[model samples]
Target chain A: MSPLAAFGTALTALRVNALRSFLAMLGVIIGVAAVITTVSISQGAKRAIEEQISSLGANALMIRPNSSSRGGRRGGFGSGTPFSDADTIALRDLPYLAGASGTIGASGTLVVDGINWPSDVEGVDADYFDIRDIIIEDGRAFTQAETEARARVVLLGKTVERELFPYGGAIGSSVRINNIPFDVIGLIASSGQSSGGRDRDDIVYAPVSTVRSRLSGFRYPGVRDPVNAIWVEVRQGYDVETVTAQLTDFMTAQRNLRIGQEADFVVSNFADFIRARNESEKMFSVMLAAVAGVCLLVGGIGIMNIMLVSVTERTREIGLRLAVGARPRDIRNQFLVEAIVLCLAGGLFGLAFGAAGAYGVEKIGEFAVSIEPMVALIAVGASSLVGIIFGFYPAHRASQLNPIDALRYE
Target chain B: MGALIQARDLRRTYRMGGMDVHALSGVTLDIEAGAYVAVMGASGSGKSTFMNMLGALDQPSSGQLIINDIALHERSADELAAFRNQTIGFVFQQFNLLARTTALDNVGLPLLYSGMATKERHARAAHCLEMVGLGDRMDHHPSQLSGGQQQRVAIARALANNPRILLADEPTGALDSRTTQDVMAIFDQLNREGITLIIVTHEDEVGAHARRQIIFRDGHVLEDRR
Candidate 1:
């Protein structure tokens, strides 16, 4: 018989017991839906974390003084010998060092048009904006001349800009930090929230010299114009860990410490931290995939069971067909086609269900999810493959039945 | 004219409980075209076994069985199936009509396996149903039809592929006497139209309708008369 005719016969058979056919397809539907939903959710989470990590600058590393221990008295972190402008400039000439900038920051209340809002204030060199990937949305960044002149010009982050100038016009406006008036020269673009849910846009930036000289701050021992931390940008194609080791060595030698002695500074790479997070997310995705795969396997087994039952129940019908000259291959094709069509139908429904499930997860679970067309295609293809694999044995059994015996089957 | 069916020294044996049970042994027969024949025997007398051999549903252990000039014994199982499609029509005592299907589609079942196009298959099925006096009940399912009407649908299904020989294993066995006469009348009419008929039954009244009768006893033909 032609394949089209075989398909028609299978369809009619399925239609005769529509409810049973749907029940047979339930397992496959749930399986494919689970695969799509889990993959999309995990993929969305990975992308979100990557974006957050990239916001911190992929090639950048932060260096800060470690906690100090002197005479059995331990001090908090960033209490050791702080970095200065000269120390940052010294690191700029190192191999693969793209830029170096010393940063000092303090939190204080800002008063703009009598609206008081508390936020952090940071003093940085001109290259700090590039190292930290901070973009100026409204006005230009302060130049080297401004830093040398200790200009009282400042840049407001998105959150501070929105709060201090709710009706706009924050740029070129004067804001008082620590009761000292400073002009807002630029508005920093939003960097969104961190993975830890911290609001990254609630800060302001000013020249390092301006903040060191104007803003009151304690200085480290014997350090001229001390800064709390130094941010370094490594050139493209350079490894952050290698540069970090070189920086630590340079700092150790600058401090006149022995070769094996531990440095008094700590260097943190954002890439390493995010890599650990990505690994965990990948593990979570793999676990969910395994569960979904098991669901699909169970679904395939369900189809096989149902098809076998169908063959048994229709034994007499099979006998009648064989008597009417149906080839064994014809009988096999009819049952096999029934299975494939059943799974393909389930796959289409599962795609719809998975999309709805993904949307539901994104809304209720507050997760990012997306369904790719390729994923949908593969899901359908996988269900059909499952049908072929599981449906074979029962179909073969039906085809091998003795015509006379099958006719006599009760 | 050459005989339409020829069998020589036909023997069929079964291995049951590690013992041989001979269903047919050293039997021989010949049937001409358009012949109306009945094979009769008591239970376990081998009439049904001989009928199964005649219908090509089972192969004889030792025999020269030829139908329509084709040596059925030498053919493969698949080839026998094809030969049956082209040459034999079968009607069982149970009618063997597909449940949940219309009479028309049930009649077209054979045509479907023969690879006839759907439209042509349906047309031929309709014609066969009309010939069997079931043309008006084409759309009725087997459950919706009476015993006699269901038998008529089965007969029409058997005729769908225009087979040269009709094989019925107790066609009227499951019907009331009244329905039996009605089904037998259709068989007579089909044989009158030159389609060879072979019916298996133990009832003398049913066998009386055939022009030829053969009786079996203990796996051998005890009587053959015209």
Candidate 2:
């Protein structure tokens, strides 16, 4: 018959079995929803990872000492002296070097006229602000000469400023770090928070040279204890790996470290972090796909069972159709369309639920949950296909019914 | 100018439980256009088998049978289905309308197989119901209609395709005398309109009403008379 006629006839039959048709469609809806939600969560996780990693810095590379021993046990956390002023100076000489910094942090209290706060006091130089995208709310960072000369100067994050110097306009005022007084030279603007809230405005900065020379006495232990990793900025379009290698080699030589002798350091550029996130995203995507696959399989089974029941219940009906001149495909298509419509409607329902689910999880879970349009499209498309594949055999069985036997089936 | 159905040396045999059963034995027959014929026989005399072959629903084991210029035994399954839709209509002893569908939808079923448009299909199906005196029952489901009414709806469905041949296994077999007369009158009216008809029955009265009668005994035709 004409496809329209086929559609009408099929629809009429399905309508006659309204409750049964709805039950069959319910399975598809659940399947589609499961697929959509899984993919959306996986997609959200991937985006979160990328956002976390990309926020690090584009032109910056980090080098931290690998102090782990033979076991899972970690060593002194750094050479305690692997990174030094010599390495920082050498970094400045490189062609692609945009900026450089060596850090030395000491957790201590900062007090300004009895307003006190627990703060992390770290040594920083010219490149620290740019590498971390640290903009000043007021005033400016201390100069290189000021830092080298061991001037009593500091940069205060907004939170640190509020707690240690709540009176406001604390720049150019003195604050005590570990009871050692330093002038607050800058107030850093507020950065909200990460999923981990690691970047809150609650810290300060001093020059690396001053911390090493006057504060910590520059004892030359393991090249210079890294309060933490150092950040090195490269010029735009510069090969970060080449710069990373040069920096590593220079540190190895300056520190008199042996080749493959556990160079006592690790260097990672922007590309490395991005590559890591992409890998993790791909892995999660595959995992979500597998989940969707399982859902489709279950959904298909539901359709098959329902269609089998339909074939059995309608034996006489099938006989009548055959007697009335229905071709095999006509019979097949009628049932197939029923199955497909069930799946498609379910897919639409799933899409709605998935989007809401992702949003709710993101809000309630206090974590980023993502849903990708293409992934959702695939989920829906796959659901319909599953219904067709699973519903095929039952439709075939119904089509193959013998008119004589069916007519007498009573 | 032509015999609507022509069978030459036609035979139909069946295997039941690994044993051969000759359902039709060398039954040669010719039926002309616009003739209302009744096939009468005792049980297992192969009257049903003969009707199936003539309606192009089954193949004869030996010899050729032609209906409306096409070889019945030689046609493919799909071609036979198409031929059935195009040239034949069937009414069973017990009315066999689909239970879930409305009378209108039931009548439109043959047209559904023929791929007619929905609007035209519905219009023609409604018209067929009107002709069968079921115009008011167009929206009724099969369960809602009486036995005789259901039979009338089946007849309307059979006529929906404007088929040249009408095959009734036992048209009045389930009806009371009053309903039987009404159905016979409808059949007579249909035959008068120039459609060929074949009715298979065990009833002498029903057989008597047809213009031609073919009697079967032991899978062989004993007599054919006008």
Candidate 3:
């Protein structure tokens, strides 16, 4: 028999037992739904993390002072000798460097119109905004002259602006940080939340010179113009790894550390960090999809059970067909088509259910869930495969029946 | 004319509880084209086995069985299936019509294996149903039809492929005597049209309608007469 004719027969049989067919497909439906929902949500989270990493500057690198051990007592990172202004100047002059900024952070309460709010005040150079991709939504960024002359100018993050100046006009406003007056020069654009669940817009920016000399009072022993960390941006077309290696070598040489002596600094690339995070997330998603795949397999087994039952129940019909000239292949094709059609139908419904489930998750849990087209296609393909894999045995059994004995079946 | 069916010492044996049970042993017969033959026997008389062999549904052990010039033992199972489709029509005592399907579709089932188009299959099925006096009940399902009508539908299905041989195993066993006569009349009409017919039954009344009768006893043909 033609495959189309066999398919028609299968469709007719399924329609005759519509409720049973649907019940048989329920396992596949739930299985595909679980797989699609889990994969899409994880992919969405991965995409969100990538965006966060890119916002921090795709080519940016963080150079921090490494923790030191004194008498077997290891202090935390940044507890050792911090980067000096000379070290920042030396790294800034590298040929492949786009720009570099030194930052010194201090937690202080800012009083604005009798509203006091606790926030981090970051000391930064004029190049900090460019390195961090922090665009000004209103007012201008800090000028080089302001950084050099230690002017009391500050950039307010969106969160700080909202808290301190809820009624707009945050630009040109005067706010006291540690009782020192500073002019708000710009409003930093919001960058949403970081992957670590920290608010990215809760801090304020000011000139590093003004912060170090007046507000923070931080000066590492034997270090001139002590800074907590240095933000480095690689020039376009220059490999980040190459620039990172150059900077590390330059820093180590300038520190005058002997051979086998651990350097007191570390250079970390944001891109590498993002890649590592993506890899872990992908592994997690694959594990989740594997669990969901087991559910689909269970569902496929359900289909096989039903198909076997159907073949047994229709033995007399099969015998009649055989006597009427149906080839064994015809009987086999009919049952196989029935199974595949069931799975395909279940997959379609599962796609819809999975999409709905993803949306529901996003709404209830406030998590990202993206339904990529490729994921849907893969899911449907997998379900069809499941049908074929599980549907073969029963179809083969039905095809191998002896016509005489089958007809004699009561 | 050459014999339509030629069997030489046909034998069929089965193993039941590790013992040989001969369903058909050393049976030989010849049936000509357009002949109406009745195969009669009591239960366990090997009549059904002989009928199954003649229908190409089973192969006889250690015997040469030929039908329409094709040796049954030499053919593969799949080849036999195709051979059956092209040469034979079968009607069982239970009618064996597919449930929940319309009489027309059930009748057209054999044509599906022939790769016939839907329109042609329907047309042939309709013509066969008309021939069986069931043309008006084409859309009715088996459950909706009476036992006699269901049997008629089964007969129509058997004729869908225009097979040369019609094989019926106790076709009227489940019907009332009035309906039995009705079914026999249809068979008699089909036989008059020069189609070879073989009917297996235990009832003498059913066998009396055939032009020739062969009786089996204990796995051998005890008598054959016109």
lDDT tens readout by residue for model 1, B75-109? 88789889778799999999999889999999999
Q: Please provide, for model 3 over A80-104, each residue's C-alpha lDDT reduced to its tens digit, 9 standing for 90 to 100.
A: 7888767778877888988889999
Per-model DockQ against the true two-chain complex: 0.72, 0.47, 0.65
Clashes of each: 0, 9, 0
- Top candidate on DockQ is 1
Across residues A1-410, which tens digit of lDDT does each residue of candidate 2 receive? 77666666667767888888778777777767777776777777776666555456667788777675656655676644456666777777877878878877667778878777887777888688887677887988888799779787888888887776657879778888778888887888876565585766777778877776656554543544334567888878887778788888877876688887767787877657666767877887788777767776887888789889988888888878888888778888877877777777777887898788778887888767777778788878887897788878888888777666776786
For model 2, name the residue pairs that clash. A2-B115, A44-A370, A80-A224, A80-A225, A81-A222, A81-A223, A81-A224, A81-A225, A82-A222
Error of 1 at B133 (Å): 3.3
**Tens-place lDDT digits, model 3, residues B1-226:** 3599999999999999999999998998899999999999898999989998888888788799989998998998778888778899989899998899999999999899878999999999999999989889999999899999999999998888888999999999999999999999999999999899999998889999999999999999999989
Give stretches of model 1 more than 4 Å off. Answer: A70-75, A106-122, A134-139, A152-190, A199-204, A211-221, A348-357
- Best-performing candidate as measured by TM-score: 1
TM-score winner between candidates 1 and 3: 1
How high is each candidate's TM-score?
0.90, 0.81, 0.83
Say which docking band candidate 2 falls in: acceptable
